[model samples]
Target: MPQFAELRRRVIQGGEAHFITSLTRCVRWAQRGGKSNAYFAKTRDDRFIIKSLNKAEKASFLRFAPAYFEHMVKMLSGQRTCLAKLLGVFTVTFKPTAGGGLSAATGSSSGPNEGLDLLVMENSFYGRP
Candidate 1:
C-alpha cells in the first residue's frame, strides 16, 4: 500500500487515462461480454469496466494486492508487463434512487446489480477496433 497515490498517478499518466471520469458513477456497460456470470458495467465514457465481485473473488484480490502493487511499481519503473494495468481496486454499490428500481440500468424490472460489490478497471479494449 506504500506510495499508492504516486503509483496510481504514474499508471494513469503513463496510460494517458486522464480523460477518465472521477465521479461516483452508477454505470450501464454498453457492450457486456465475458465468460463469467458476474454482472459487468462500463463507465459512461467507455474507458473502464466495472465487474461485480463475490466475497471469494474480493478476498483473492486482497490477498495478492500488495504483491501486485510491487509488480506494478516495477512495471512503471520500466520492467513492462503484459499484465493488467489496474487503475483502482475498490468496491462499488448501486444505491437505488427514490424513483424505485433501476430500470435504466438494464431496461428491465430486475434489480440484479443493486446491493452488489464491484471493482473498476481500465478497459483493455478501449479505443480498439
Candidate 2:
C-alpha cells in the first residue's frame, strides 16, 4: 500500500474536506442509519478518531467506492450547490509481505493481502437532516 506520508500528501493536495478509512471490521453498531460501514483514521497531523458507515451493506459501494469518491471531489471543488457532494477516491496499493523461510526469499504472495478505499468528502460530517 502507499506509504502513510504519500497518502497524506495526496489528501492535502486534493483539498478534501475529510479523509476516511473504512472501519468495516472494527465497530459493532452502524452509523448513518446503517447506510455505510465504519472507519477510523488520523487527520493530517495524526490526531486519530473514529467514524462509522454502512458501506458493506451495499455491493455497489464495494465495487465503485473509489470512482464515487473522485466524483465527489470534483463536484465539491467546482462550487456547485447540490444536496450531497463527494470529494475524491484514492486506491492504496501495498506490496505483499514475504512468508516462510525460502518462500519469503522467493517473493511469494503468501503474506497479508490487504487494501483499502479512501473516500473523501465535503461536509459529510455535518450530519443530514
Location of the lowest summed lDDT over 10 successive residues in candidate 1: 102-111
lDDT of each: 0.64, 0.41
Q: Estimate each model's TM-score.
A: 0.64, 0.33
Query: Candidate 1 on 33-128: residue-level lDDT in tens?
Result: 666688877766566677778888888988988888889878878897888666565554454656874423433433455546667676787678
Off by more than 4 A, model 2: 1-32, 40-82, 99-113, 124-129
| Tens-digit per-residue lDDT, 8-97, candidate 2 | 445444322334343222222223554344564423333223333344523455576566545645644674545333333444445454
TM-score of 2: 0.33
Candidate 1, superposed: residue stretches over 4 Å from native: 1-4, 13-27, 30-35, 93-115
